[model samples]
Every structure is written in C-alpha cells, then in structure tokens.
Target: MPATDRSVTEALHKRRSVRAFTGQPVDPALLKEIFAAAQRAPSGGNLQPWQVTVLTGEPWQAVKDEVAARIAMGREGQQPEYDIYPRELTEPWTDRRFGVGEALYASLGIPREDKRGRLARFMDNYRGFDAPVMLFLHCSRIMGPPQWSDMGMWLQSVMLLLVEHGLASCPQECWAMYGETVRRTLGLDDGQILFTGLAIGYADEGAAVNRWPVPRAPLGEVIDWQGF
Candidate 1:
C-alpha cells in the first residue's frame, strides 16, 4: 500500500512498535517527504535538538557488523552513553515493561524457560529487526532533560508520519547499549550522544511477532481530568 491522507487518530491507531518487516525497500523520495514534514515537530524553546543519521545498504550493514563484533566480546564491550532505563524501575512502570516483553515472547512461542531462544530473539535488536532502513538519533551531550523530552516529541512525530505513509517503525533504545561502537562506526564527534535507533520499513504483518497484541493502560489510569 502506498501513502494515504490519514487522519491523526487513524495514524495513532495504526502505529505499532513493529518487530518484523518485509524485504521490500522503502522509496527514498517518500522517506524524504515524511522527514521533511517531521521537521515541524515541536521542540522546547525552538531548540530542535534531534540529530538523525538515516542508514541503508552498505552503511547500515557496517553498523550491524560493528555492533555484532562488540556483542561477541560480551558485556565488557558495551559503552552506553546513558542509562536506557532507570536504575531502580518500580511499580507500574516495571510491570508494564515486563508485560510487553512476556507478550512478545509468548507470541513467538518462546517459553519462559527457553533462555537461549529468548536471548537469540533479543539480539535481533542489533539487526533493526531486519528493516530496510535505520534512523540513528543523536544529540549534543550538552542537551539537558528538557531537550531530551523534545527529542521524544520529535520521534513521536516521525513515527506518526511513517504510519500515515503506510510504513512501520520500532524505536530501539537497545542501540544505546552499543553507543560507542555506533559513534565510532559513524565517525560521530565526542560531543554527540547516541540516543536511540528507529527501524523503518514495510511491516511483515503476517509474522507472529508483528501480530502480537500490545496492550495499553486505560485512560483513567494515565489521565488526570480534574477540570472535566
């Protein structure tokens, strides 16, 4: 399916953290159009702090190779620029994270006891779930939490735009685990910090991993409507 004029609500409903993608390559012109529109995404104090490097073909393969080599060296090879999650995640947040993970594994038919199976699947993060393109997001090291929040908004905008264009994506913070490797492979300066990677392509909708039902909290649990 090609891009359509979709409503924001429709785009929201269509968007998913797609884990499987077809081999079909996305059109470069379409990608450029979507990203150009995404530049309008709101930022705090008009500071558009998000810096993205879109990769495909040989460049993307090179990054995966570097990360794979690092993975072979074990945990000691990791050089994360920042913590992907809080040191002590508690309560609802922890439960939510665990629930999604369990659901994903269940959909893949990997039981909780199958440690090796699960590990193999988890390692797929480095492959961008085999998506055709990888958008590596980074920002200046000097950017504070507020700017980081702005980056999140920008990412959301991009994802929604992708959905509207009949595309899919997965925002992988797991890339941050190999931050230094990515920086070196891309020849990024020390002042820049790798934040995350977005895998984009046509979704493999028939795949079990892509078909899993991702749950969301009810509005009451997340929203506070005192005025209403």
Candidate 2:
C-alpha cells in the first residue's frame, strides 16, 4: 500500500514475455535492486525457501555451451527427479494451456502439425534465447508446497521489479527439467532443487516471438465478487 494502486496495477498489467533482447549487459546495481525486491516477497512461516544463482559473462555462456553440447549429442542425459506436468489435465486448465501454446506458436507461423518447429522453439529456452542475464531459482528440500508457493510470489516480485527497471523476463520452468545439470554446474547445494530459470534483459522489440502478447480471460471469468 506504499505506492498508489494505479501504478502498482499498471506495472503488473504491463509485465509480459519478452524473448529477444539486445546484447547489452545488465549492470550490477540494477541486479542488486531487483534481487532486493525479490527478497521482500512474502513467505510462508517466514521461510523464504528460495535461492538464486545468476549467471552472466563467461560463466553464463559456459553453462549455455555445455548444455548445448549435450543437446547436440541427441541426449538430454540428466533428468529431473519429479514430474513437471500432471499426468492428465482436465477442464478449463486444459483449454487454457492449449490456448496459450497456440497463441505463442501462431505468432511465429508455426503450425500445429509442425512438431519439429515446436521443438525448435523450445530449443531456444536452452540458449536462454541468447539473453544476457540468466537467473537459476531453486527451493530448499525442507520446504513443502506452501513454501513453493512463496517461491512463486518471489519470482513474480522479481519479474515486476525487472519491468519497473525497463527490463523484461521469461520464467522458464522447462529449464528446471535439466535440474541436475544446472545444479552441478552452478554449484548449488544438493539439498536445493532447481525450480525454474528466468531470462532477464531488455527485450529486442523487433523479434517476432516478443510480439506474442497472450491474452488473459476477463476478470469475471476468474474472479468472484464477495459482496459487490
């Protein structure tokens, strides 16, 4: 409540997926600001549960190369310990998932039948889509689902903070599927598990992928008034 509601709500609305970015490096001061905002996110039982390893310069590119090399060998050798998606998705969730995928690929002229085309787009996630700053986020083993929810709140805080700084981000859960490799390479403790990665930087405005502004359903569709 420290800031005006309009500014807060407007920032939330303006946050979007920005894939392509110029090669400019994110400054340390800016990163400090973003992380500080991330730190302020609400937590469960006062357990923050989240840890972040940000990569840039040689380290970032090195991890990219290592993963790319593995992928080039036709093998995603290291597997995640848990499932990323439910075995079955039902109801409105299923429709929403499909719609998002359709909208995203449609922006790039990728047809539904083009399996390889879709794979190519996912492959971009591996390269951080050539993003300058890559953030690896993980949660501690001691935390449960509620704590995981807190981690998401923190992630959203980081995303909105980036937007306020004129930067864009993409929270890549798919990146966590390579949790083992990401952990080993990033020197994360074994007790910490990769939750996701965020691609951060100025979005390349001209890129086709950045043009996809996936729509959200109207408020009435998702919200119920208590006593309007």
Question: Model 2 lDDT vs. the true structure?
Answer: 0.82
Give the range where candidate 2 is weakest over 10 consecutive residues by summed lDDT. 1-10
Give the clashing residue pairs of candidate 2, or none: 20-204
lDDT per residue (tens digit) for residues 30-134 in model 2: 888679877989997778888889999899987787777666756546566467778687867888888988988988899999999999998988888788999
For each candidate in turn, give its C-alpha RMSD to the true structure in angstroms: 1.1, 3.1
Off by over 4 Å in 2: 1-6, 72-78, 226-228
Clashing pairs in 1: none
Per-candidate Cα lDDT values, in order, are: 0.93, 0.82
The best candidate by TM-score is 1
TM-score of each: 0.97, 0.90
